[model samples]
Target: MKSFQELGVSKSILKALDEIGFEQPTPIQEKAIPAVKSGQDVLGIAQTGTGKTAAYLMPIFGKLVKAEGVDPRAIVLVPTRELSMQVGEDIEELLTYSNLRYASVFGGVGWTKHAELIEPGIDVLVATPGRLWDLYRAGAVSFKKVKTLVIDEADRMLDMGFMPQIRKFLEVLPVKRQNLLFSATFPEKVEELSHEFLDFPLRVEVAPSATPAEKVSQYYVAVQNYRTKLNLVSHLLKDEETFKRVLVFCKTKEVAEGVFKVIKRKSEGEVKVLHSNKGQSSRINAINAFKNGEVRILISTDVSARGIDVSQISHVINFDMPQDYEDYVHRIGRTARANEKGTSISFIAEDELFHKDRIQELMRADIEEMPMPSEVEIIPISKKEKLAQLREIDKQKRENDPDFKGAFHEKKKREPRKHPTSFNPKSMKLRKGRKDGNNKKR
Candidate 1:
């Protein structure tokens, strides 16, 4: 309940926050700002939409005071280009009353443009791991002036396989700089990363790691098959008044494209689809459109789940369960952001029930199951689809229990066949002759 002023935020930053209508600090910010100001390494565990970005940035801004050199004094590393852009925007907003220079660099655009961006010098630099490393190798940026290093969304960076680049950064950056690592969830791998990244860091957490936002009303609808899930989504969107802005998350690009096509044909609103394969400009435009309220619905894979920071998303629909249980938290976190109440509806097929159970276990709460709407058409599962579902279920079981050999595995087990070289034509002819002689004698 403490105000930003009471938390020891500077007068200029306070004015900027006030202009932006930010009256009070969120739980994470309230606890983290002071620890960060202490100049000790810090580890933060807070879900998305809890103002963790400001928790670190505000204190860092207070330390920077004014721009000093051409090279960046602080580097903020994120997992995706979208996140890099978002953090850069946040820095711009926070430094509204100051003269600090900052630049955001990521792939998808020409490196020359980014090189031009940092040429004049910047106080803060936000970038993805690969792009940052590339810029450094090209001699466009320097680490000697970087007094603070922030690895935001550490879990996502690890998930995206950026650990090697992160380690390389650790090797190249100054050892005397402050380290701040933040993540939505703290898995075993993240915990290991923390040990390597932080120096006796003070840990701050707003909630238990991986817990979904309490304000989000989570629900699930059981469906017969994939097509039925699509039917249910289209049917639910028919009530446009309640489902004003929605994010539909799929497990893969193909499924996201299918959902996008179905929703576009059935609904009368602008819809966009985003995946890794999409062109970078197209993906950025789609996200910007959705954020600006020009597009009502967006279908995307988990790649965009953690990067999106829109606060007014009315609903989050899981067209397909995420392969990683931790992603379920990030997907739902998209809706209930900025202390706004939101809803999350998941389509649970037979094959996804095991994943649903695992996610519920991680959240320590069950998602309310809803009866299928009477208007939605339920498509029957084909034999091929049914077999595929069974096989997927078997795979899930084997992942949890190595001793588990499901029915499909049992059926697939067969005796080894003879090699082509093992054929014997002479023996076959002799046996045939003996059989003919016996028949003639008879």
Candidate 2:
């Protein structure tokens, strides 16, 4: 329970922290700030919501705020554009009253805008690998003056195929700068990179890696198809007593919107969807509104699962299971923050069964299966209705299929060809017969 003031932070930083209501430091922050202040390399192992950004940012600010020249003394690298924006914003706020100059560089924005920021003496450069490399190639960056380097979300960089770019950045950057590596999980690749990058790094971990939130009550509901999933999700949301601010995550942007439409029908007007398919301003607005409690329900792809710094999220509903088990951890992490007990309810259908099982094994968590609501409450489709649909399918088959049950005269069914030859009109008149008079003779 050490306070930020007791951690040897200067009076100015203490004043700033107190103004921001940051009195006590979290476990990770308390342990890491001292090491980082001492200029020792740090390999931090902490989850996203544990105030990791501040754990590193506080120390960087404490050191860089008093810096004289702005030759990119500190470089903080993030994995995604959203994360780059978030971290840069966090730094900008803490350094608002100070004379420090910071820059945020990411893709999807014009390179010209970034060129102006980097050209000036930026004391702290918050960038992604791709843009950083691009700027370096254009001779707009001078890495020789960097004093501290941070690679936030190192595991994601490796996952997104940025190792080569990371290698190149390392090769070009100054050798004697401090390195800070932060990630929730330490895969083999991240561990290997830390060895190559950091010098005598001190490892600091506040929570066990890969462990889901304890405050998050997690369970799953079994269903049959997307239609069933939709029905189940809508039914779950109708119970206002349980779902307050629910976040539904799908694997892709299309599924996010698709599920959003299905759920919005029951929700009337409280539901909103966010995905990459939307324009940048739209997505940013949606996320901001959700974070501000303007939107109580948000349906999004797992892209928002990473580095979205929103607290007070009551429940996280998984409309579609995640492809990687690690994603399950990140998805649930969005909820159950700020010591607030939350729930992670997953909708497990036939298509998501395999993914659900793998996620279970990865987290080493035994998921309690929740039964669907009573048949009467949820209005299950009756057996008679299902049978009638099957009957209609059979009737359609009999009518449309001329040789439905007979063995194919040709061994292979006619499949759409990759590059089918053109059918000549003169040679395609009839198939060995004239049907008009020949059928009457038969």
Candidate 3:
């Protein structure tokens, strides 16, 4: 209910906010801006579309009145290049009236451009942990003046195994600085890392972590196998009236590409695929196409679950359920943004039902289940899919009992590694020595 100005935001930022049409602060922003301005480390937990990025940035910009130092004043460590770009763009939008400069450094691009950006010095730097560490180690960037260190998407950083990289940054950064850790979800591991990174940080939670947006309607369709799931996706996308501006999330890059191919062949709408395998330019183009409405459906892996900020996303279809339960919240968060109502449909294969139940348990709300359409053929499972399912089942068994070798484990252990008997070089020397000894004895 409070305006940005009422929340202690400066006149310049307020003017820029007005121009950007940010009429009022979101719940997380309302709570976080003050805490950040108080010069205390903050552990902020809110859903994806709640403007968490701006929450930290506004305060950082408010305090950073000018570009004073050759080194960056604030360093925002993100988990992905897409998020680095997103945060950088958000900062640029908020700096409409300020002379402060910020650069987004991430992998999948030439370091030359980033070196050039860092050489001139900037007030803020948004970066992925690995690339940022690389730049700093290469002496292309400095953090001596970095008074504020932000670990955005801390949970995702842990998921992507960037804790080591983040730790490296912590080692190199000044100890006498403010630390802010923000995340959509706070699993135990993420919480542990937050404790390690922060110094008596003020905990801020606008909504319970793993809680999906209330405005988004969630549903799931039961399918027998991967092919059936693809059929279901194709069927749903055909209904353009409701599924406009849709986003489909797959569990892996292979699944994402498969879904994209199937949808491209079956549906008449424009479609794009996004995954780690895609080139940076292709990923950017796909995201731009989706944002600009050039593409009606965007199929992607979990990579885009947190980075994308497209409003009016009519639907987010989980072509494959996310392995991480927290990612379910982010996948659905893609829709129902900016106070708009949206829908999310998930395709649950028989093997993925347990994952679905885990997600529901985390959300404390069961996703409404819908029957698969009769017309959509339940295709026979391919050998590859069958093997994948077996592997998943084996993995689950192993999780319950570490001693449980997988379905293929016994076969692998029993199978003999072949070595040619006639060409045993290891014994040939002994045989020759024995023959020589026999000759000498004779």
Candidate 4:
């Protein structure tokens, strides 16, 4: 493996990297730095933990640090606020040896503060689409001086319906600027957008798109229901040796809150819940606590799965199976980062097995199933749980074979409404005659 210095990284930036204990470049960074430096548009395919942020940031810094710019030379577009913050922090760390201004602008916060920060001009601007667009409209940002435009997590941006905003940026920004599109997966929509956005881009991929990190040991435990899954999570966390610095992903905010309550009550360690329902400050606090080792467990929804950049995470627990198969990859990618071995344990109920099957199909590897721990008692499946399972199976069948509705699918029979005065033809004619007679008298 070649060192960062061998990749044309400057001594000053190398010093900063060394301070951060980054010695060798990861595969994505190793291959992408050159391509990014070459100034051609790049379509990079790499998972979250593959150092893709540094891949682009290194070359960007090498060029920007030498030049004097005021109007934001590089703009990185991220899908979520968390990602915007993560990428912004990476940029800050990379520029520790340089005197460059960078700001992370995202929603869930007032724009006035960000506007004030960027009004004086920024060298690097990391922002989400909505807030960036808002800033641009507010005349707080300028794209004329932007030399390089990066759309990180491009697939997620598309999934979140930021195509129009991205196109708006393309329309407003300088056409001569370089473009870099990075994503974990390139779905049809993402591919289509790349064609529209990039010009003859060099493609760099460290692994097949949507493939989970190989270092993550993935396993699933079958459970009876949500309660049992909670019990299992509580039981597993007792082994602090293996389940340190853990992230628990749920499919919904309510489930995440429930799991957080359960773990907080059962475990003696610090635990927090993160989701859209929580305030922005709370969410950020939860992430910081987890990252700083102040919190032992973080229960979150898919919102934080891909955006979190914490290192040394020992485990990722899927409290609920992700509805989107691609998310399973992102959830597990949270761990096994920085070439560290990590474990991913998923709690699967019978109803959620199909989701697991879809995830396995996407990864092209079946996760090993483990017997439930002896401490977790197998409670009888509740009727409500069984009905929910049936509904989920029905939903899956409908997705696969539209015509085959499951047993739980009962189309509501609508009773036709009856008009009080026009139930029959004779009554309708009499009403019409009375109306005509009244109009004639008037």
Compared with the true structure, model 4 gives a TM-score of 0.91
Compared with the true structure, what per-residue lDDT tens digits does model 4 show for residues 176-263? 9999999998778889998998999999999988899989999999887977887899989888877889999999988888888889
Q: What is the lDDT of residue 22 in candidate 2?
A: 76
List the candidates ranked by TM-score, beginning with the highest: 1, 4, 3, 2
Reference-based lDDT, residue 162, model 4: 90
Cα error of candidate 2 at position 96, Å: 3.6
Off by over 4 Å in 3: 381-442
Tens digit per residue, CA lDDT, model 1, 200-271? 999999999999998999999999798888899999998899999999999999988999999999997899
Residue-wise C-alpha lDDT for candidate 3, range 216-303, written one tens digit per residue = 9999988879878877888888889978899988889888888888999999889999998888999889888888899999989897
Cα-based lDDT for every prediction: 0.92, 0.79, 0.87, 0.88
C-alpha RMSD between model 4 and the true structure: 6.4
Pairing residues by index, what is the TM-score of model 1? 0.94
- The number of the candidate with the highest TM-score is 1
